[model samples]
Target: MRVAFVSFETVHHRESETNRRLQTILELLSEQGHDVHVCCAQFWDGERSTIKRTGISYHRASAGLEAPTSFLARVPFVLAKLGPDVVHASVRPPKQALAARWGGMLARAPTILEWYGDGGITNDWWTRRAARWADWIVVPSELVETWVRELGVDEATVEVVPNPIDVDRIDGVSPGDSVDVVYARRLDADANLESLFLALAELRTRDWRAVIVGDGPEREAYEQLAGELRIDDRVTFAGACSLEERLAIYRGAHVFAQTAEHCVFPTEMLWALAAGCVGIVEYHADSSAHELVEGWDRGFRTTSEEELVDAILEAGGLARRDTDDRFASYDAGAVRDRYLTIYRTLQDSSSLV
Candidate 1:
């Protein structure tokens, strides 16, 4: 089967979860012997042509192209020319969905629309229309399912699929004996890094070291908070690393803590669990982290700074249990089979049609 992925920009062009998922899905399909072509928005440093990386074939448009214009104008040409068995347009919230619809109509191919963000509460009509046009809708968590349902898409069309991760890359490292708390998220205003810094300040007397990875606008503010609390020496900021380096940090740390005000999916927390870290999260009732903590009792959950501090201290006491088996279902090999099943079902339906 030939699959065409219509992701405008991916890790091949940008370092992001959307791009990572697009690349991962392409690799998995390619490994299963499907002819996979990834059409991407181009980058500056020479990734505009066809390049094969990790068993997946990628094709890119020119650099600095706007999402709206390019999706409407350029994508149809690629779809008409490639002639794939299925066209998958991932995370089409606005204009991209229209392009995907047009592309599918012109190519006469079944299209799968994927969205990982929350729905329902947001009053975005374009996305709702896109949901209607899609042959199938894919989301990472049940929280997203609720949102999609509210958009009035048929229940049969929406499918719950976990975000795929390279579980083996996070596996097999023995956890350190001393308590090391790790947080790997963009240090932006919405990330709520201040709460974590205050919590860490509360834990300065305790036997623990807090490491914050990734960088953003609030780095200086967070550093100031750490300095004010006099815990700056104990807290290390390891800003933005390669995939291997991030995985190495996850394996070396004993606890993973995050305070995202409102995130649809906590990908970093999942990685921490897969990496054998005792997970701690600060999430309110409406957030997706609540769903994660509710399902997996392994992690500690809190909403306030005090509660977060207590949870961190509690995480120090929690015994490190083997988590590789629990997260095995999310491994690339297992998820690849799951996706193959979806593709086969799509193929069978097309054959009947």
Candidate 2:
């Protein structure tokens, strides 16, 4: 399949959940020997408007990242020129999605929107228009599916495709030094580390260690909070860790805590669960983190600090494991197959039309 992805900005310009997810999908498609291309603001240095990287071709839709209007205006022309079998677009600058839909129509291809619902235009009017225009919308969770449906998009038009993980890469890593509890996420306003910290303080009398695995603006504040709670020594703020480091930490730790106040999809929690950490997620109104562990035996959901403490204690009883086969379905290959199925369905439908 010749797949063309439309994104105004790529991960090369800035690192974001949406960009990273799109890049992963593109690479997966390329690895499978499919023709993959991305139309975005030029991120490479030179007079060249097109460049190839790791088997995927990137064509510039605009001169640079600064001009949104230019990026939006040129996306359709670029994609139509590329003439891919299918067009996949990121749902950020909502207008670009509309442009991609137009491009798909011009190119006689089907347009699918990947809606992470993390960052993008939030105006109901724009979002609703974008959702309605796409051939289909792909979201990370049912939580996002609900949001897209609320925009009056037909339920059948939206499908939940989870963020993919590298199961083989995870399986190959060796577990790091053991710790009693593990929490991984950017330490920002939504970190919600306090719940886990307070819960840990409650168990100060117990002999257990915890590791907080990430870094951000709130790192100092969270570190200070850990100190104030007097669990600083026991809780290691390991800062931002590579995937290998995080996997090792997850494999070594007995329990992984999910306390973020908001999550489109609990990515880190999924990784920890795959690494065999007993999942303990604190339920938040806006977050879909608990969705990953709702019916799973090795998972626990808590609504308060006391409950978090209790869940941590209970998870201690489960036997430690270095990896879990249950999450094998979330492997990169499985996710790529899901996308391929969608593309084939859309292509077949387009042919009949």
Candidate 3:
């Protein structure tokens, strides 16, 4: 099958969960013998408009920031250039998908819009209009499906397809003797780092340390909070690390904690669990991240400072059970097969019926 993956952003241009997912999916499609092409706003070379990698072709147009008002102006050119059999767009929804739908219509090909999150622009006029225009809609989680349905899409038009992580890309290395815990994510209030720091302070009786990774608006405030709690010495603000370094931190940590107040799909948590960390999620009303730890038998979730402290204390001292069993289901090969199932089904189905 000739597949064209259209996205507003690409991981090759930016290191993000969405990009990682696109790379994984494109790689899988290529490995499955599908002729795949990726189209997006390129930021890799700053000025280069196009490039190719592995078996997939990449076409870069204007940066999203440069043409927010006229985003679809370049779609016709990209479509004419690629001439895809089926266009699969990776998008959060409405705008990007809408652009793809318009471009696909002009190009006379089926278009599938991929949604990864919820609660953003679902009610926009373009979102509802474009959703109705697409051949099909794909979402990564049940939570996102529920939200999209609320936007008036027929249940039959929406498919629950998860964003997969490259489980094999992560290697589990010894966490060393430092008794360290790592929490990595953009430092935003919604990330709930406040709760994590307070919890860590509560567990100061232990000799454990924490390594916080990433940077955002909340970096300075979070740093101040750490000092106020007198736990600065035990904590390290490592800012952001490259993809390679983040994985190394995952393998070296005794545990991984995600304290986000709300999350559509927490791909980082998946990496942590895959890397053999005793995964822990801080709960809120809008989170379903705990679901990832369901059968892993390798982690738990908490809802408050007390619970987080207790879980950390326990996870730090508990005998490390064999984690191999926990990560078996998340193997990259198995994940690729999941995508193959969806792609094969779509490929066999009639176009734009």
Candidate 4:
């Protein structure tokens, strides 16, 4: 299959959850021998209009990120010329998705917009129009699907596609020294580390050690809070870790905590669960993290610091496992096939029309 991805910016421009997801899908498609192309403002340095990297092709829709109108103006033509089997786009810079929709129309291909519901301008008129104009809208969770439906888009047009994880990679990594608890996410304002810290403080008398595996501007503040709670010695703040390092830690950990105040999809929690750690998600209105643990035996959903503490303690009785095969469906290959199925179904329906 030939797929064209339309985004005003990409991982090369800035690292973000949306960009990472797009990059992963593109790489997965490329690995599966599908011809993949990305249309966006040039992020690579040079006057060249196109470049090929790691088996994927990138075509410049504009001179640079400074020119949004130009990017929107040229994307359709670029995609039409590429003539992909399908056009998949990110829902940021809403105009770009609209442009991709136009491109899909020109090329007689289906267009799908992926809505991450992360930090971005999503409440504008352009977003609603893009949601309605695209042939399909893909969201990471039902929480996001509901938000998209609220935009006046038909419920049938929105699909819930969970973020993909690398189960094979998790299985290949060796477990590190064991720890009783693990919390991993960028220590930003919404990290909500305080909840987990307070829960740990409540159980200070117990014999347990926890590790916070991420780094951000708020790391020092969280560390200070840990000290204020007098649990600093027991909680290890291991700064941002690589994929393998994190997998190893998750494998060795007994429980993984998800306390972030906002999450469209709990990517790290999925990783931890696949690594065989008992999942403990603190409910948040704006977060869909709890969806991952629903109906799962090894997962626990908590609403308060007290519940978090209780869940962690309850997780201790579960047998330790090096890996869990339950999440194998979330593997990159499986998720790639899901995208392919959607594309083929759309292609057939469009043909019938």
TM-score of each: 0.84, 0.97, 0.81, 0.98
Which candidate has the top score in TM-score? Answer: 4
Q: Of the candidates numbered 2 and 3, which has the greater TM-score value?
A: 2
Error of 1 at 209 (Å): 2.1
Model 2: per-residue Cα lDDT over 224-282, one tens digit each: 99899999999998998899999999989999999999898998989999999999999
TM-score, prediction 3: 0.81
Model 1: per-residue Cα lDDT over 1-353, one tens digit each: 88887777677556665556666777777877888886666654664466776676666643445654755577777777888777888764355666766777777787888776642245478777888888888777777788888889899988877776787666544443343788888888677888888888877877678788899998898889889999999888989877667777777777888787767677777777787788788875445766556666567878789998888877777766534467778778888787667767776787788
RMSD of 4: 1.1
Worst 10 residues of 4 by lDDT: 119-128
Ranking by TM-score: 4, 2, 1, 3
Pairs clashing within candidate 4:
none
TM-score-superior candidate, 2 or 4: 4
Name the lDDT value of residue 82 in candidate 4.
94
lDDT of each: 0.74, 0.91, 0.73, 0.92
Number of clashing residue pairs, candidate 4: 0
Residue pairs in candidate 3 whose N, alpha carbon or C atoms collide under 3 angstroms: 214-239
Per-residue lDDT value at 222 in model 1: 87
Of candidates 4 and 3, the better by TM-score? 4
